[model samples]
Target: MTAFTRGFRLHLADGQVLDGAEFPSGRAALVDDPEFGFVTGAVSVEELLLGYHGARIEWDDEALLEGKPRPTADSITSDQLDALLLKAARADSTWATALREAATVADGGRENDCGCGGCDTCAQHRIGLELRRRADERDGGRP
Candidate 1:
């Protein structure tokens, strides 16, 4: 059996501890954590740590089967999902549609909200009622 190395571990807000591992999109055999670590994705290690603290998502480091991505907001695209749907739509449409819809609901709430860093309705401010409403709506009531 293949052995794995240990890497950065995160203590999640929900009392779950996740370890970082690396894999090539999981089509091959499963590997232990520490091979790829969490640095292989667009989201940084700090972002994953913060997500753990913020309770937005949860993950683990157990050897994953093939096809399990690095697990991040930008890991996959709606188009890729659409393609998969096109291929598998006939299998079951209800759960697949809901998965696509719910999984994609957080797309617009990316890190581009503060593009200018000078607007009155800046990402930080949200002081006024309108700004707060907009921000809340934009995040899908997540925050």
Candidate 2:
């Protein structure tokens, strides 16, 4: 069995100590214990730390996972982009439809002449172009 590294220590008000590690997503993952089995899902490490008031926190800088590069748009895969678009569609159908249409046009090498960046059409076109660019990169320069 692999040994778990203690990256941080949380001293709770009830005289209990918890060991946790910082994930690459900036969230804290508490070690598995009898009461809590590998707790996580906090929005961020700060939020998790802030939740327990009147608690002392200890950090092991060497053991903590920090300074990890976050995933950029270029690093996303086409399937991931499609999943995001699908999620957007589920949230806002009209907006997602417009974006899909704009992306289709962009994929066809069509350009929008609208100079106003704030306009809905222009914004959609820009997002669509970016999506196409990422997709092309993922496809090894093939549109």
Among these predictions, the greatest TM-score belongs to: 2
Per-candidate TM equals 0.20, 0.34
Model 2: CA > 4 A from native: 1-6, 32-38, 62-143
lDDT of each: 0.40, 0.59
lDDT by residue (58-78, candidate 2, tens digit) is 766422223322234457467
**Cα displacement (Å) at residue 139, model 2:** 53
Name the regions of candidate 1 deviating beyond 4 angstroms: 1-6, 21-40, 54-143
What are the clashing pairs of model 1? Answer: 22-36, 26-66, 26-67
TM-score of 1: 0.20
